[model samples]
Target: MPTRRRTLLLIAAALGLPRAGAAPEGGYRFQRGLMGTRFMVTCYHEEGELVGKAVAAAFAEADRINEAASDYIADSELLSIGKVPPGTPVRVSPLLFGLLEEAWAQAEKTGGLFDPTVGPLTRLWRESRRRKALPDAATLAKAKAAIGWKKLVLDPAESTATFTVPDMRLDLGGIAKGQAADRMLAILGKHGVPCSSVTAGGDVRMGDPPPGKEGWNIGVRNRDVDRNAAELVLRNKAVSTSGDLRQFIEIGGVRYSHIVDPATGLGLTRPVSATIIAVNAATSDALATACCIADRETGRKLAAAQGAEVFLAEG
Candidate 1:
């Protein structure tokens, strides 16, 4: 709710030529560096004159997706829903609907561990960090009360989102990356263009890398290394990573992760990181977030339930 914000990261695209076995189809490659994060977009066809136009078109889609899910912005659709009273019909695009619906399912499957209604909690952390402080148990508990998916009433009939708890807020930054990838894939296909991919920071959605190529090559990344770097391999699938290795703050020599566990209003310490591969980006994204908050068993169960291939890195 409150429209989504950049509590998440940000993007663009520059396509590469066919390297040996890369996809056969050719297109214009564009790079985008907007949002807080950077990524690239590549299409199957274009002309020197159309280069600028194609870049604009691809990023226009990214911009729309970002606006819908960013918490930093105040007028995003997600934010609009937070302000609306329960049961009010709100028109939403198919991509947003799918993202929210999947987010709802993942939250239930994870037993609130992956709840999207944590805008208030994340906002607290953002403020707490800025204030050079952390939330006390009392404050955290109160914030936890404001978090839960059941409190949301979503109606497909009218595409309405209702909040059962007035204080409850939804945050899609954690899952919107996948939705964006899915939408981009659709848009690319609609144009009958082939051989390309889109990457937003760590989340990447790739097609048959120009034809003849096996698939999208990816590296699960060692966060200990440079963040901008990743390994390369063919993995015709969506992959995501979550860990306490990075994005943490040190207090008294103890590191606290940025990824919060909705179950306890804190973050998980064990299982340093989790990398999951799934057919859909949203499932992998949601599961990665969920696994970060769950124990090994719980994570395993949920991963299987989601039909995701999960590899847990023991700490």
Candidate 2:
């Protein structure tokens, strides 16, 4: 698998001091490296010790999810699946099975715009970026041949997945971080942390507003201006962004984003960034990717269908 890419979104810290009764002393914040990116959790709780334990649990949950889904991990379930013979069903853990199901559904919903089967394309681009050159037409063709969500077979009942085409690979990098953030928030909730937020890189998931605030304030970065374009007050929601600004390769005076178009085996060129706010981090993350691959109108329609809002920045 290709080396992991940097988180594509930037989230500004909430501005201002916590309101009265936010926590006994103040909200506790914790950050750690997980899933090849920084995962942070902030919680409001009466007991500092409880907050610590809850944060630890949340991070642990994130790590567990990452271990199961990360394609960069050599022994990860995702990589193990790729190692299996084509057309041979390989049973996966419950977590991976569930995620695979969700990914397939999202891929279908977006007409394959958001596909986990783009691993081959991702690797090709990564190599091209490393070499400071574009992949040759033959190599690009081979990579494209290995991409197709329809070619991946999933058996939910048996918790098994298979690739119809040889050398096909799956990469959950597009959606796993968002799912991990959501799972971390769930772990925090299970520990009785009522108001909290978990950010797995760019995918931010919040349970509720702080003790006295209407909603958590989040900043959406504008790469063209190198400033925050807008700050959104959100509660019980998730936001994610996909862009080429920070993670891209320049070749022959043209910029190629890390966000690849699986359909064409090429990186997006026009849209500099795409952001989405939705009811869940996973959906928001997948939709953000879909927005990057689609035209503005089509992207907006996709987000609207899911009761989410999308912002696309183009040159």
Question: Who wins the TM-score comparison?
Answer: 2
Off by over 4 Å in 1: 1-28, 43-55, 84-95, 226-232
Query: What does candidate 2 score on TM?
Result: 0.90
Candidate 2: regions farther than 4 A off: 1-25
What range of 10 consecutive residues in model 2 has the weakest lDDT sum? 2-11
TM-score attained by model 1: 0.81
Cα-based lDDT for every prediction: 0.66, 0.82
For 1-315, candidate 1 gives per-residue lDDT tens digits of 111111101111223211111222444444455456665665444333343344455556777878777777888777777776654556777656767898898788878878889888887766655665678888888888877888887788877677776666778767777767666765665555545576666567766565555666677753454553345554446777777675676554555676777766764545367777777777787788777777778888989987887766665
Per-model TM values vs. the true structure:
0.81, 0.90
lDDT string, candidate 2, 1-315, tens digits: 111111001111222111212122257666666777777777877665565667667777777888899888889888898787888999999989989998898899899999999999999888988898989999899989999999999998899999999889898889999998888898889988969998888889999788888998899974664678899999999999889778888898888889999877988766468889999999999999999889889999999988999988887
Best by lDDT: 2
Clashes of each: 30, 0
